[model samples]
Target: MRTVEEHQAVVTGLLAPLPVEDVPLAAAAGRVVATDLPALVSLPGFANSAMDGYAARHAEVGTASEAAPVRLPVGADIPAGRTDVPPLLPGTVHRIMTGAPLPEGADVVVPVERTDGATDVVTITGAPDVGTHLRHAGEDIRAGDLALPAGTALGAAQLGLAAAVGYASVPVRRRPRVLVLSTGSELVEPGRPLQPGQIYESNSVLLAAAVADAGGDARTLHFVPDDVDQFLTTVRAELAGADLLVTSGGVSAGAYEVVKDAFRGLGTVEFAKVAMQPGGPQGAGTVDGVPVVTLPGNPVSSFVSFEVFVRPALRRALGHTSPDRLRTTARLTTALRSPAGRRQFLRGRFDGEVVTQVGGPGSHLVAHLARANCLVVVPEDVTELPAGAEVVVVLIEGALQ
Candidate 1:
């Protein structure tokens, strides 16, 4: 039997960083930046107004107040996006709107609310200090400055920043393509009425979603029959275009274990029992030069195996700086037991300070897994823990109930 860390290393070592490609900013969201992106233009580009007001020299409008109002002629109206802004005259103000470029020789802005709201000649009721309501060029970021560093995950704000820095497309690592297959002759598709001893297939759906959530492009080939020759043929046909092959079921020491039987003949994939609960039966290797990771058939086992092994590997392949889930410690709300010499990952709901077990340590508890936000990790040497014992927890994003 292999330790969890040993198996994880074997699985993770199979994949390398994917090749980089340039994708449009619209399609770059959730992708990792391949290289440092520098700003093409300074943020703001030029001096502009931060508010709708009259732009003038502070010396002219500094003393204007409601008690002693000052009257000035408005030279030109400047709205946002007006490129050819006229200069402010010696004794005149420009009616500038928010985000409009500041006219040459203008140093201050008197808000429209503090003015008489006139076009030709406006009465100023208050005076703002020099540089008020002005956005200087390069205030946010200077031209040629680093806008986003390598390995940065692109999100809405990151994409917006890239666009603001004049990047229509960004270099990012290509998403790994995973071909998912679930085997078993007794499995039937959902929405189809089940005959005796036949169950609806769910591992393909579960594994495919998990692959996508880990930044991989997943394609599921559902319900391959339990014949070793047929399974091998089916997998080989679709193996050409996939970076990885992820399959669930038929790997255990059972009579009808087609995946184990077929892959053992190839002499590439290695099947082993990982020293971990819910997902002890694990296998990792390659099939015809493509990486393969075989997970157990149980719903929770498949999910946990993907989380513990495949998710991090897929993210690392996609160029993510942090490939693993967020881990922290929380006190257990109740006592828990684990089999000695086997690491246990129990589904739990963590409320920042404390974690409560969602259900018993059963691999088939899919509903319990659905209600869990974290995995309460019990080490291989640990047999039991008292209530209030601090335990390690791995937070699964979007898994909260």
Candidate 2:
């Protein structure tokens, strides 16, 4: 049997990063930048007023005070967005609004609070330092400077930065297209009447949603029966557009294992049992040059396997800098026992420092898996652990209500 890390390495080695493409800024969120984006124009492209004030020569108001006020005639009203206004005349103050372009030859700005409210003649009672209340050109970012570096995942702030730098579209890594399939003759679609021995098909929906949550484009084909020829035909038909394929079921050592039988001697495909509970039977390979990953049939097992393997591969293909789930340590709220050889990933709820098991370690307990916000990990050799024992926890859900 392969160790968990060995299987993980094998899964990751099956595919390379997807190609990059240029996409509109509207669709760039969650996509990683392909190259460094430089600023096309400086922020605050021109010098402007930082406040509503009077533009004047600093030397004229140097000695102005409340006891001895200096009165000057307002030459012009400089409102925002007015570009035809002339430069400030010496010894005269201009009434300037916030964000208005600073008039040339103006050495200082005196706020309205320090002047009497007059349109024609204003009484200046205070003096300000030179260049006060002025926003200089390129104060936020300079033109031709690096606005966003390569590998940056465009979030709200990153998108805003790109827009500020005048980017309508950005070069980014393409989102991976994943084909998710669930195979079994005993599976029926949900909401339909099931026969005596059939159950509802759910792994496709579960795995597809998981792929989308990891920022990949996912499409699920209808469930295939336990026929190797039909499964291979369907796979080949859909393999043209998919970067990776994920199949659930038909991998265990059963007589009707269509997935195992179809690719048994492909030379590129390998099926093995990993040293992990709930998801021991795993498969990885390439079919017709497209990466294929086969997961176990149980709902919980498929979900856990996706979290352990497929999610990382999709994230890496999307160029994520940190591809693994957030991990931390939490104390066990109760004593628990695990098997001797397989590393256990028990569904759990972590309340900051203490983690409580949600259900028994059964691979088919989908309801328990739904209620879990974390996976409490126990090493292979640990058969039993007492209450309050610290265990490594992978935070599956960041915020749990």
Best-matching candidate per TM-score = 1
RMSD of each: 1.4, 2.9
Question: What TM-score quantifies how close candidate 1 is to the native fold?
Answer: 0.96
lDDT of 1 by residue, 202-302 (tens): 99998889998899899999877788888899889999989999999988997989999999999999999999998999999999999999999999999
> Model 2: per-residue lDDT, tens digit, 93-191?
999999998999887889999999689999999978888999999999999999998878899999999998899999988888999999888889999
Candidate 1 — worst ten consecutive residues by lDDT sum?
392-401
lDDT of each: 0.94, 0.90
Model 2: which residue pairs collide?
none
Clash number for every model? 0, 0
